[model samples]
Target: LLWSSGDESRGAEQALFQTVAPFQTQVSEIERSRRMRGKRQNLA
Candidate 1:
């Protein structure tokens, strides 16, 4: 029973990670693009 409970928690944790991973990637990408644009403006 303890082993099964541990597995269930692990599965839930993995599901949460998969759900958030894409949003996290998108947020980072947006931040990176904004930084690049700022650099370009400075150059101009």
Candidate 2:
């Protein structure tokens, strides 16, 4: 009973993470590009 509930929650958590993972990568990429742009401006 309790074990099954735990498994169910774990599966939900994994599903949520799977959905979020791509957005996280996109955010990191955006941050990286912003930093690069800042550096280029500083150099100029």
List model 2 lDDT by residue over 1-44, tens digit each.
99999999999999999999999999999999999999999999
The regions of model 2 sitting more than 4 angstroms off are none
RMSD of every prediction: 0.3, 0.5
lDDT, model 2, position 11? 100
lDDT of 1 by residue, 1-44 (tens): 99999999999999999999999999999999999999999999
True-vs-predicted CA distance for residue 19, candidate 1, Å: 0.2
- Pairs with steric clashes in candidate 1: none
The CA lDDT at 1 in model 1 is 100
Show the lowest summed lDDT stretch of 10 residues, model 2. 1-10
Index of the highest-TM-score prediction = 1
Candidate 2 clashing pairs, residues 3+ apart or interchain: none
